[model samples]
Target: MQPHFAVPNLAVPTFAPASDAGLPLHIVTERTLEAWLSQQDAATAGWARTMGFSGAWGQVVVLPGPDGTASGALVGAGSPKSRQRQRFLLAAAAAKLPEGTYALASDLPADLSPEVECFGWLMAQYAFDRYAKNTGAKARLIAPEGVDAARVEVMAAGETFTRTLINTPAEDMGPEQLQQAVESLAEVHGATVTTVVGEDLLAQDFPLIHTVGRASDRAPRLIDMRWGSEGPTLTLVGKGVCFDTGGLNLKPGASMALMKKDMGGSANVLGLAHMIMATGLRLQLRVLIPAVENAVSGPAFRPGDILTSRKGLTVEINNTDAEGRLVLADALALAQEDTPDLLISMATLTGAARVAVGADIAPFFTDREGDAVTLASNAQDAADPVWRLPFHAPYEAMIEPGIADLDNAPSGGLAGAITAALFLRRFAGEARYMHFDVFGWCPSSLPARPKGGVGQGTRALFQALPDMLALS
Candidate 1:
């Protein structure tokens, strides 16, 4: 079944007109708000003091009306510097405030740009209502002055698309479904798409991809999409393991529980693509997704199997569970063959990445010093946090297993993420490459970010792309 490609309409909290808003919402910081609070009605000031509502970050308190109805709300935003560093700080108000439209009553901090406030409001309103219903109405906020409403809407749409793709179960989001989604996106943006599927992958020299996916009933494929023709080339490769049952080396029940999210890298890549196309960023963009399901069957590739990659390197499958890298290897080699100006590969490739950086922060590996510095700075500026881990040349030996040109999984298991990256780098060749080891699942809920499939590193990369490529 071809998956529907219509961009899902996110329930962005409505932005009411100032005249129609219900009550004043004062977002005050710790160091700059005592005098402002004292100037408020005496009764409201007493109510705040009685409730111990000092302006600490994330604190929300409602003021009482003359008839004891909600008069307004006071939210604690931390220092200007701190508030500027985080995204969606006002989400606490959106999630907790009484269901009514609120307007910003006081002057916002200089650091809190209109874009930040508007984007935060939109993000705070996201909820995954695919399986169940979200019947509760969310509080509305008036769009802050000087904000670009259209830009905010586009960003929200892109993020919603990503989260929806990741949160859907594997049964509904396998290889075929992934292709449909890509086709849908391409159709919307007037981009061209091509796919090499099933036995044809072998014919095309993508042996590792076919070998990993051949066992599944749903035929595996490579989704290639391109947009624009007049700018520097930017190629993105994502691991699209729709459902990783770990092939012949099956995962435990606990490990397989969330395997549905293994395709998060592709989902995020598509999300970033949406942002670029929607905003009309000038670049020649290409996206390659090696979509597959690593299932166990009589034909499933097994351990110790030798598979030739598209780059002509032989890989020794030390562990069938290490299938993400194998599929990515072929796609990466294909991407490098073009020698694009910039190439990025994203994957839910290793658990050690999660152990090292936790779920919220993504870690990236890159050999380009200037690109690394640019990405880190843009991540901070865009409020999408990322950390850099070394490519570590010495660990390259860990990927060589003596028998084959590379080992999918190395022994000792130290720096698993690094070893996996090294395995991919062999195929990336000399292209300016960056690999993101991302945890696409958000295990716990935060203010605007719910507990479900999330996009990691995408926003950071999106924000940095133009500058990194010198297209800005």
Candidate 2:
């Protein structure tokens, strides 16, 4: 089996001390290129022109010194209009720099904070070389002035862990492997992990989890991880459908192509757990992941089946493809058993989410107004963009079929994401819960962010937890 916990090498000298000797990295924008050239020496001006350094986004040009070593690097920040539309603008150029360490120049025209760029530069160092021989870029950046390097490293590691887990295909990332990952992470963080697998899930009152995963030989499970003995209790529930074959109602070839990423929710929460534990945050953190493979077999649950959830709510399975919410329903119910101060659930649960916000934005629903505001501000500052959707009470009717308490997949397919959020809301009860309907794959590459599995709302949630739970 492929290594389940192979995250980016955080110990690499990606961010050197501010006092370290390194070349200067100039953050340049298209509007400032000519002005910047005017203040340079004749040789430097000639070099810039010769290299066609127009300061377009992500363009990198190394400036060689008289001794033949790199004196500095010019990284394009693009135009203000372009800068406004993109995230990690500085990282675009930073990721392309040579292997040598470089420090940010004193005269940066862009309004971005040094902390954001530091995190982005570190994020660029990620390489998923599990199966391929592709040589990724090797660039080391010095921790910019006035930045807390430790905090940035924690954030980057969390994101790297999330990406690595999602990037691994189902062949090497089954339910067993997912549990191994949780155990590995727990060991590293000095936390405790417990798992109830197979028929034990039924014995443990997790009928929905067992029913959805009974068809597969790999066996299904509920993974629980806990850390931190002090402060507010925060429980995170992630839907861990290791591989969704759509059960009996199979998805099309194109749709099934990315089924390995069905466990993105599990990856995300695990990533978030890393950040919280590594930082030694003053909070009791609990994570619940329902690990399963929604594959077809003789015992697989089918559509039109009315099954009772851990919350005692009966769900009518209108589409087996919508199994994520079923597993999450049981996990959420279990999470509520502890009566956490804050509960958050992340899931790659619906195509309707991608359709609603496209792939770039993570759309979330929350029960608290103040938590929503805190998250919105933090997401903007963290460069992890998110959008909020109402847990529309009106749509509650759509999920209620006459035969059961709720419908897994509502008819008409209108407001699918909202209806799915509403469906999970039933199991959550009255907890201060937030649900993220994330599109875990990035369709295109952008700077430090690669074109494979991506993390959504983790950063925002990390930044918000301090305020949301009064963890300070």
Q: Judged by TM-score, which candidate is best?
A: 2
Instruction: Report every candidate's CA lDDT.
Output: 0.84, 0.86
Candidate no. 1 TM-score: 0.93
Off-target runs (Cα >4 Å) in candidate 1 are: 1-22, 64-71, 79-87, 110-114, 135-137
- What is the C-alpha lDDT profile of model 2 across 1-472, one tens digit per residue? 0112343332222466667788888878898889889999999989999999999877889999999988998888788777777777657776677777788786555467677777888877777778875444577777766788888887887888888889898999999998988888888778899999999998889999999999999999999999989999999999899999999998888989999999999999998888888888899999999999999999999998999998899999999999999999999999988889999999999888898899989999997889899999999888888999999998889999989999999989899999999999889888889999998988888877888998999988888889888877
lDDT of 1 by residue, 17-43 (tens): 656856888888898568867788888
Question: What TM-score does prediction 2 earn?
Answer: 0.96
What are the models' TM-scores? 0.93, 0.96
Best by lDDT: 2
True-vs-predicted CA distance for residue 109, candidate 2, Å: 3.7
Candidate 1 colliding pairs: none
